[model samples]
Target: MGRRTPKKKSREIYNAWNQTCWIKGVTVNPMVTLEYNEWWSRRVNDNISRPNLEEARSIEEYLRVVPSELEIIKQDFKKKTSELEKKIEQLEEENVYLKLDVDL
Candidate 1:
């Protein structure tokens, strides 16, 4: 096909975009409707840079989440608390042994 001008290309996009909004008896000017104008503006300005297909990941990979800082800190806290509790138990046992040694 011949190269389509930017205005023609946008008009085609607008026509395809609004194809479903047709009414049997009523003709609507897409430019006149507030919804269409808003949609057009968004469509024009919504160009976001995205990774090409080669760099794209699977859905699961995209959806996967790394542990947040709070979660990591909570896990570390739990580990430290458990270690301290074990050390406290060992210290209590040592104290009991010392008491027995003194009482002997």
Candidate 2:
């Protein structure tokens, strides 16, 4: 009955937050979702009666930084790729020297 209103409003917040997360291509982590829930509660005290689209959108943007492991992996990939390229050049130089010696 009357109880449904608060529950529905809460769902609106979760829906907006989840939708924004989906659009931003990030996993909906519990910690961030709980922060959103707390923010919604505080906004209710400020006479905001509906889920805030802007708030949800901003949360997604804030959480969108590349994860630390992914950054480390990217750096490692660059290092390994450079090392492999250098090794290939060295091998090619040695092959040229071997060919010259064979001709001699």
Candidate 3:
């Protein structure tokens, strides 16, 4: 008979769930964020000094910057949506004039 694998401890499962919640909410503490940023900077600086580097370092940097990048994207999306709404309103006004011209 094959032996059964052991199940994960309840504490480990709870910690994993808690980490998921924190990540989903982007709820990292400011001090933790600063420390992570510093660690990333040091890693990037060290990679720059290397003779040849893989694409992984760039990917790592992207991961490090993702939260700020996501905020910029969100702002840009709102700006674009506002501009689109204005354009849509203008088009509706133009359509009304075209309908009046047809009716006449």
Top TM-score hit? 1
TM-score of 1: 0.42
lDDT of each: 0.86, 0.86, 0.82
lDDT of 1: 0.86
* Tens digits of per-residue lDDT for model 2, 58-81: 767788877699889999999999
Clashes per candidate, residues 3 or more apart or on different chains: 0, 0, 0
Residue range 1-104, candidate 3, lDDT tens digits: 85444554666787999999998677555446777889989999988865555544675676774458888999999999999999999999999999999999
Candidate 3 residue 92 Cα shift, in angstroms, is 0.5
Q: Which stretches of candidate 1 lie above 4 Å from their native place?
A: 1-62
What's model 2's lDDT at 53? Answer: 79
**What's the C-alpha lDDT at position 47 in model 1?**
79
User: What ordering of candidates by TM-score runs from best to worst?
Assistant: 1, 3, 2
2-39 in candidate 1: lDDT tens per residue?
A: 89999999999899767756552245563377887898
